[model samples]
Target chain A: MRCAEHCEVVANRPVATNQFEIEIHCPTVALHAQPGQFVQMRVQSGYEPLFSRPFSVFRRFPERGNFSVVYLVRGAFTQMLARKKPGESVFVVGPLGNRFLVAQPANQVLHLLVAGGVGAPPLYLLAEELVQTGVPRQKIVVVNGARRQDLLVCQEHFAELGVRLRTVTEDGSAGAKGKVTDALKALHGRGELSGNRCQVYTCGPTAMLEAVAKFAQKHDLPCQVSVETLMPCGLGVCLGCAVKVRTANGTDYKRACVDGPIFDATEVVWE
Target chain B: MSEVKLSVKLGPLRLQNPVLVASGTFGYGSEYADLIDLNRLGGIMVKGTTLHPRAGNPMPRMVETAAGCLNSIGLQNVGVEAFIREKLPFLRQYRCAVIVNIAGDSYEEFEQLAERLDGVEGVHALEMNISCPNQEKGGIHFGVDPEATREVVSRVRKRTRLPLIVKLSPNVTDITMTAQAAVDGGADILSLVNTFVGTAIDAKTRRFKLANITGGLSGPAIKPLALYMVWRVARAVKVPIIGMGGIMNATDAVEFLLAGASAVAVGTANYVNPHASMEILEGIEQYLREQGEKDVKHIVGTVKRCKPGNEF
Candidate 1:
């Protein structure tokens, strides 16, 4: 069941430069939330910014009855959200959208997780779930990229999970000096990725996702992407978050809020 | 303290309250069932249904503006057949009036839709959505011209005995002309000021925010304009008016009642607050008690005008 509640903020602190992770106490949402599912948050009471913004559930602490979201302070909504302190109440509707595919224990598929900038939250959660599900720690490789060093979030979190971590930066402030796709090529050159045995999961900016999708398609690797779009009402009614995908007939639009924020790369029609 | 009567009559159709959820915003009523009591609403105007399904517009279909939002959803729905087959049964459990909002690409489609749903169980009325600004055909085109508006409403009016409501477009030279035209064509009620056409631009990217380039603007920003139009139309036509445009709370809802609207529909507010319509309904009753009005009807079209010598 989905819930709409005014949850009290348990903790809200900056995890990286210009990025903050805020946890809210809502047992129903926290316990039900899965990787790639998100919550719609109302930043303020008034209509300065009228619509609620959708944030991915980065971490779920069911025992504490809390779920955290990692967000970048890009616009007015985020700017206001960053100032929210512990004990402040924020209206949130959650455990929405579909979740990413978790590897089965019996399967021997190699899992490659890729994340860019603030997009690391959901992927990090996916990595944690994979490790818990008995996917070997060596089989799970997380490639994290950002514009600079500080914007790269969730690297330490993924490291703490005892999985392989690869970092890439556009300015070369840290890790390899290149895009995430460049690091993937290096991994492929090292024979770390196989066509039929590997599965790729990515979340990031549109440009980067498009590139990642192309690479996954070229290698015949099964890929799932977590897409981010402007959504008015995260609950399926608004129909504002549309993502075009390939259909048997030709192409059709699907709601990213409900149908998925996570979609198979083969089905998505990249612009 | 006296009891406040919230029930209102819109032509032959009557509502338990005067607060109905606008079409497209409420979905099939099941979407909000988990959040609020569906039986408490005056009515539930489900999403716009057509002769066939629609894929709608491309990505970036919505954008946020100051105190409002713009959307070009293109009336995407599962057609009338699917609506009756899949969506209606869930609504039958609720006591609220089930008003099917229908949109057509032509006069034949409109007539067929009305005829198809005329005797359908649980459907109390039909709200003709001729004012959707996002569609390429049959939407704003029919609403902009008074002759087309009259022709389409009259065509559907003949096919169904259900109370007919003609939703009017705000993007017109004079809204009164279309309101009178709908009434002249046998409309039982009027829902005014659908949405004002607007656009948004991204300064950094130097591109239109919406994929459709221009979308319809709906929210608190258009409240005053909508109130003015409803007041103007109420005097021009005898039919009861369902005023809507950025009505966020009970105060805004009551303002429409005083401005000549018999009832009001909660549109964008449903998205902002899932329980907005319920709160607005409670607020209306509270306002009635505070004003010493026993019936909500007592306050309809009661706006006082300033006299020549008494003007401030």
Candidate 2:
């Protein structure tokens, strides 16, 4: 039951460097939102930034009928969204796109979740879902990477979930001084990552996603990636977010709005 | 409470109303089934189709602007055979008219596509997309030249009896010449104006915003420019015109109607609101009832307040 409604903001606060989280009382959207789905939101009434921006659903409070979105202040629309006061109305259309699919083969599947900078929200929510669904917290590993320590905002959330958390930053201001893919390599060297029974999930920038995809392919492990694109309308219409994917016939286009925001890493045509 | 005639006659084609969803914006109709009532719209123009499949342009294909957005989709579609086989059957279930928008690199490609779809069931009309650049010839050269526009439309017109609508490109100078040319080419209806060519660059990154440096601009920013073109073409040719560009609301649709357009297509507004077409349709009906007009046709080209300037 997707819906377009004017949600009232409950809290708008800075959670990290240049990143802010907004919680709104949108019951319909909160009820329908899954782990990897997103919402198209427009904050301003005027015609500037004429298109709605797509944001992944960071948190959902089904009991209180509220949902949260975390976004980095990158442009005018995001700046406007961050400046919005509590109790202000924000137009939102959600819970859109295909969600992250869990491929649990017996009880041997190890879920390796990866997050890159602003792409953390969806993967965090995914980890939460995996834990709530009876997957042992020890079987799940959360990997986060950012430019600096200030940008790693979801460390505490993953810790509270009792999931094993590993982090890396480019500037050595965080846990490990390298990329998340580096941490992945180290885990594989230690025989922690298995090609046979482990499943990988990630949400991040295209470069990072491509690296993860290539790594998973090399290891013969299955991986699912939540991609990001410019989507004016989160629904299947607009055709604004066309992503190329490898099909049975050849390479073809799929709309990121509907076909998936989440797609199997092997199927993505990384050119 | 008088009965208002919302039906409109566009040459040989008759629409239940004057509000239509533009091509490229609306993806084959099923994408919007849950958001709005499909039967309420006058027509549905699916994505642009070609003879073969297209992968479209690279990523970062769209960017937001002031009151508008730009796109370089490069006409990404599954081609004609797929549409007739896989897409058409689904569209047949809807009550609204299903209009197929086709593009090509040459007159022969256009003719072949039109011939293939000539007797296809559920295809209500064929929109000849001359706005696309001719891949065989360089530049946005086909639709810009009156001769090419005439030949393409005439060839397509000969192949399809289902009403032919020649979509004109707005990049050309003196749009009337092209409008008159399309009518001469046997176009039943003329739909204008396609997106205007525009570009945007990121000052900080020192790079273009879109993967394709120049993309088609659509939305509320171009409404005034589209209105003037529709009005100009409406006065030039006797064939009915389907006006579109930056139509966001019912008032914009009414403005196009008053400017001599028989019908209007909601393009960029669809991206803004999935239910925009239905809202515009309802708005038109409400406006007609409020104005005490029995027929929407009465308002076509009815402006008598302004006189022609003495420059002529």
Candidate 3:
């Protein structure tokens, strides 16, 4: 749907520096979304910076026709988006990217979670779903990293869910002082995410995703990663989102907008 | 609820909406079938292709900026043959107009591409991407230098009966001259204001953000510039103009039309909202209703622009 400059922002706030965790009332998308879906939003106005920025559905509030995404104030578009107050309306194109795997009754008893900065959004919702699906609250260990202490937001919600929240700060202000790599390495050594036949779920920056992919593969754990890409047509008309995949389908192409924002780590060329 | 008809005509092509996908962004029309409704568009313009295959520029080719984006993709494509055989079939399934955007390094290549596409099924029109004016034999906005622009436009104009649309480069000092030259050379239509030359630096790394030292800047930053060109070209040439650059909303499209374009295309917005084109069309109809107008064509070039609006 072409988002008319008319949808009221249901929730808008500063979750971090230039980063916001906001929600708008979009029943159509809420009703249509599957876990791991996304929405395309024009970060700003006019023709100069024309394209809309795509964000994953951090948390979909279907009954309320609202959803939220945590984003950094990276640029003018996002900065403009972060500045939007509740009740303001803007055009939004909708739950576009392929979603994450829904809660399935697989044999793996635990979910090893990894996130960085705003990457915490998707994992947060995934954890909520897992809790609802009878996965013990204690079974999910979330490893999150941020450059500084001020960048972390929404900690209380994850804590309230009884998840084991582990923090990695570039500086020693938070939990462990090193980085997420340090946290994962610690977990790997303790068998928390090791030879227990765990399923790993992750979404973060390219470097972090690459690191997680290597760690999961090295340990032979089943891993899936969410890929962030520049997509204009979430429906796959714009080949801007084409990413190389290691698949029999074809050697050269997979539209991240449609084929996936989430994919098996081994199937992707994690460059 | 009123059923607003979003369809409009751009020379020989008929679009379900006025929002056509800009060139160099949407590839060969078949790539995005899964995430979008292909048949529900004004038209789709594939990447710039030439006589031979092009791998395009190197990695780090695209960099995301504040309100817009910078890219030096350099027109990567698999040449016209692969596009015709592999892509068109899947694209044919869509009911919308399919406009082939052609680019070349030489007159021979442009003519070669044009001749081959003359009768391709589902190929409704040809968009001559005269963007890289200097790298090729002619120069960027081939139409910028009227003689060369006319030469290329005339050559391709003669090779195909499909409507010839020359896409103009905005890096020029005067766009209307180029717009007029394309028409003078028998261009059936004109798509104005390709990306403007721009740059972004990584202050910490002390390096350019894009692989290519300089990239084309697109989005809201270029809308006023594009609208100016459309206004100038609208009054200068009789051929229909498909204006683009930084159009993000229906108001933006309507503004471009009032500046004298027959239709408007969404370029960089594709990066933000996958359905921007469809969204703009919806916004345009919403505008027409708010304005109490029954049709949209009446607003073409209806707004009087500040004369300097076309200047760089």
Candidate 4:
């Protein structure tokens, strides 16, 4: 059951350049929140920035009764959120959208988790869960990418999870100075991944997701992507966050808030 | 203080209260059941339904502006058959009135929709959506012209015995023309000021923000205009009015009642706060009690206006 709770800020501070992670103490949300699910936060009490902002659960500490979201200060809402102090109240509605597909299929021998910039939060949670579920640390690989070194977030978190970590950046400021797909190509060339033996999970900007989807298609691997859009009501009533996907017939729009924020790569119709 | 009356009557339809969830904002009512009580509402106007299922428009469908948002959802919904089969049962379990908002590309389709839902078990009323600005055809085309509005209303009226509400478009030269026309064509009530046709542009990208190029605007940005239209339509027509557009709180709702609306529907605010409708409903009762009024009807159309030639 989804609910609206006025959560107390536990910690809200800068995690990296232009990126801040805010933790809120909401037991219901933390206890029920799954990886890739998100919470809609009402940043202020006024109407100037009317709609609540949707943020993916970066980390959920169920025992501590808290969850955190990683956000980039792009506009007024995030800017305001960045200035919030611990103990201040933030109205949140959550445990929303679908969770990442963690149940590995029999043929899938390798799990490749990809992240681009702020998109790393949900994928980080997925990596943590996979490791907890007894998936061999060697079988899981993470590709963290961003525009530059400072923008490449969550690399250390993945490293702490005892998984193989790879870093990519647009400029030569990180591990591999290329896009995430380029790193995937290098991995494939080295036979680290084989056809139909790998399962890919990615979250990032649309351009990056499209490229990853194409890579998975070419490699005959099942891939899942976490998409982002302007979601007014995370409850699916607003129907504003539309993601075009392939249907049995031509094409149709699916509500990213309900049908999924997580979607099978092959089913998404990239424009 | 005496008990305050929240119930209201709109022609043949009687509501438990005057706070309804506007069409399209509250999806089949079940979507919000966990966050708020569905039985506490005056009515639930589900998403705009067409004779056949609609896929709606392409992305991006919605964009936020100053104190408001613009959307071109194009009335995407399961066809009426699926609505009756899959959606209606969930609503039937609740005590709140079920007001189905129906849109069509032609008068024959409107008539068919009305006839199909006329005696349906859970349906309490029908809101003829001749005013949806997001659709490519049918909707606002018939709504902007007075003659077409009257013709469509009467055609649907002829087919259904349920209370009929003609929702008016605000993009016309004069909204009262269509309002009076709807009343003249046997409409039982009127829901004034559907979303105003508007658009937003991204200066950085030099592109329209919405894929539809233009979409209907809703929220507090349009509240004053919606109130003015409701006031105008109230004097022009005798039927009750369900005023909407940018009503975010109890104060906004009361202003509509003072402006001659018998009831008010909460729209865009529902997205901002799922508990908004309940909060507004509680606030309305508090307002009535503070005013020393035992009945809400005492405040309907009670705004004080200066006499002609005596204006300051």
Tell me what fraction of the real C-alpha contacts between chains A and B each candidate also makes: 0.73, 0.73, 0.37, 0.82
lDDT at position A13, candidate 3 = 80
Candidate lDDT values, in order: 0.91, 0.87, 0.75, 0.91
Sorted on lDDT, highest at the top, how do the candidates line up?
4, 1, 2, 3
**TM-score of chain A, every prediction, order shown:** 0.97, 0.97, 0.91, 0.96
Local error of candidate 4 at residue B186 (angstroms): 0.6
Best by TM-score: 4
Per residue, candidate 2 scores C-alpha lDDT tens digits across B261-310 of: 99999998887877689889989999999988989999988755656694
Please compute the TM-score of chain B alone for each predicted structure, in the order given.
0.97, 0.95, 0.91, 0.97
- DockQ of each model against the real complex? 0.73, 0.67, 0.25, 0.82
Per-residue alpha-carbon lDDT of candidate 3 for residues B176-209, written as tens digits (9 for 90 to 100): 7777778888898899888887889999999987
- TM-score of predicted chain B, candidate 2: 0.95
lDDT of 1 by residue, B1-312 (tens): 678899999889999999999998988998888889999999999999999988898878898899999999988889999999999999999999999999998889899999999999999999998888888653448988999999999989899999999999999999999998999889999998798999999999999998899899999999999999999999999999999999999999999999999999999998888889999999999999989999999999999987898856
* i-RMS, each model, one decimal: 1.0, 1.4, 5.0, 0.8
Q: Rank the candidates by DockQ, best first.
A: 4, 1, 2, 3
Model 1: how far residue B109 lies from native, Å: 1.5
lDDT, residue B176, model 3: 73
